[model samples]
Target chain A: MDRLSEVSASLVGGFEYNCIIFFCTLVMAVPLGLVITFGSMSRFKPLKWVSKTFVWIIRGTPLMLQLFVVLYAPGLIFDIPIKSRMTAVLIAFVINYAAYFSEIYRGGIESIPKGQYEAGQVLGLTKPQVFFKVVLFQVIKRVIPAMGNEIITLVKDTSLARIIGVTEIIMCAERFTKQGLIWPLFSTGLFFLAFCGILTLLFGYIEKKLDYYKG
Target chain B: MSILEVNNIHKSFGKTKVLQGVDFTMERGEVLVILGSSGSGKTTLLRCLNFLETADKGKIFVDGRLIFDADNKQKPSRAEIRERQLNFGLVFQSFNLFPQYSALENVTLAPKLLAKERADFKRNKAAIYDEIEKNAIALLDDVGLKDKMNNYPCELSGGQQQRVSIARAMAQDPKILFFDEPTSALDPELTGEVLKIIRSLAAEHKTMVIVTHEIEFARNVADKIVFMSEGVIVEQGAPEEVIDHPKQERTRAFLNKLSK
Candidate 1:
């Protein structure tokens, strides 16, 4: 195959990096986000302060800057080489997304009325049971749209891994551009648009399913 | 013998005393109506009985066991408080049904969790859930919400939500039920449905302590009426004796104000 044909054929394989980043970050970040939310909401002052400070620092800076730091800072400061480009990307992306997700989780959890917890207690539910069985579902339902938006943003964010040499789709397209082909770079946008469109539909269906929670 | 006992229950929010030296007891199957104006501690008394509000000073007994005593054990742990919560069901003024759950789920949840806590239920988990579901459906039918079993609390009207909560209360087959002005959050028209349900429960001779301003309903259903004023029970007797032939000035004044 010529360069164009090869580029066309290789698009799926090249984009695999973005897919890995997207799904891996999502699978790890979401539960980490919930754990961070619990830390932020902890009754113990120190845990809450530490959680808030960590989130504040991540959210205050750019993901690109965090990526640079995650890639170079350990090697620079402690003489420890981060050998895997993918590992650094995963760590940076997961940390950044988890900070954002924790805030959304916190807001969703707090928006629930105190009456809900009281009703659970009155029914003799242990506190953990009340949280997991009753409150967790509501939080998930309420935060889905917000989470969906973040996940879509993540598809675009996977492009940032290219800066650290992850050779994601955008990087592949850029290589094609160096070879005097502009079509692949533009076509990458089509790939994202389809991904995002499918995600939007999935989220719309979820929000519809959760229509039972008009309260 | 008394099924529920509260002795000198005292609670204060900051400097404002809510329940001052409140005392009451109820026999099994007796309906006790706690009648009081706002700020008179009727709601606080009910909360204290269920360990919702820790009493600053008091002793509470459920099924002849000392569940709480402020002086004896000043700071009960959450686990201890939770253990005490198992003895009674509470229906809130706002009908605080688990909004995320359907009417049937709201009725079945606690009982299901309670069942899971027992060793026997572990062997027959499916049977436990089925039995609880059947009872919950029957209870929802009893509260006239059989058709609305799959509806969420937000989907139901205030009266219907209140009815669902009443069914939710009966899910655990509580030793006694507590109503914290169950109709206070309802419209005047909607209040009738909740009142009717309470009337039916009273007829069934269910042990209940209802803190309400519904004088007529209270009078008609309560086996014992307690009138409170300024965080004190100023008068208590048979509804006819207390409402119609009250001997205390505070009681007469409160009734007169309500009447007007």
Candidate 2:
């Protein structure tokens, strides 16, 4: 009983940290991802190559490696510690997820027909208006399924913060394992499964709402 | 004065030439039908008149304004060019309605976006909605799709989709409408329906430029017919003179081939 109470109390701050990371990633990654998509599609050679290379490198490496390097690299290279472990984890999450989200965005935008663009031009719409009014909604509709997969994956990837000593849900569960109380570690699965189930329902609702755009 | 003029317009794609020094002119309120074989630049010539495809070397004048003049080749200011573009509405071979919008919304999009009149967004919305409902229904009635206003383009058939496209263009109320092979994607029955609607529109004295292979439709509806070959206007006159009594050997051979 004492072990359960201790585990729960210790997790309060980590739960808050987890929520912060979740919200920040959603707010930052969507727009950052769009910008990265533009970079990948840029007519200029250098910008396209640089953006694609960054995405490839981030996607190739494991998130655990990224968390460690991000948390320690600033301190090691510049001799000025980043000071906040939470900030390092947040930065690493934003950068890693933005790359994945950008590829999804690019795929969605490219799937639309070239005729739609020509039709917009014929109607005397400027390039920006065409993107916002015509292309944006279609792209959003096409990408929702792919985006849902990434977001559900993101919920699990948040556990990678344990490597940086951020004390997220899994880390709180690990401490109980050291004390010979396996129940708390198993209890953590309840939190993860429940969260994932809610996310699945949320994404299913979104897919239903976008049903009008079915090809 | 000629309302629109094209002189010596030429266009080439990498290695294949599309329009080689094409020339023609149209009086105000004149309906000219363009007829030609498939790669003879009939569609390319129509696109050039609206500046949809820039000509490599030519002069095009709309209402005596030098919209494009290759010798001095000064593209007009953006506002000037938009003003000239407002004079015509173009309908494509494929129905290019924005699939995201409903049929009514598709019809009202251009006017709402341009916002040339109406005081505020509310007034504009009301006016546009009214305009779309009224003319959209009328256009659909004319083209025979009066019941499908709420449906998206994807929900309609190829023929019904083309009618919706015609209605969408008519909603803009431009002085001249251009149709590029509008019935090529439809079956004979659907083609008959669209052609019948176009004939009624012609009765209303709507000035138009149509590039089509439907010889009988052109003969019945076109005030003048221009026969093109190898990117140039080989012959042009009243439909009877050009289609029935051709002077050019190529025009006669082309007509005979289609007749067979």
The best candidate in terms of DockQ: 1
Q: Name the lDDT value of residue B224 in candidate 1.
A: 98
Residue lDDT tens for model 1, A39-65 = 999999999999999999999999999
Candidate 2 Cα errors over 4 Å, as ranges: A8-13, A76-80, B70-81, B116-141
True contacts kept of each: 0.83, 0.29
**Which pairs clash inside model 2?**
none
Candidate with best lDDT: 1
lDDT of each: 0.90, 0.84
Q: Least accurate stretch of 10 residues (summed lDDT) in model 1 chain B?
A: B73-82
Please give the clash total of every predicted structure, in order. 0, 0
* Tens digit per residue, CA lDDT, model 1, B108-179: 989888787677987899988999999999999999999999988888999999999999998888889999
List the candidates' TM-scores in order: 0.94, 0.91
Model 2, C-alpha of B144: deviation from truth (Å): 3.8
**Which residue pairs come into collision in candidate 1?**
none
**lDDT for model 2, on a 0 to 1 scale?**
0.84
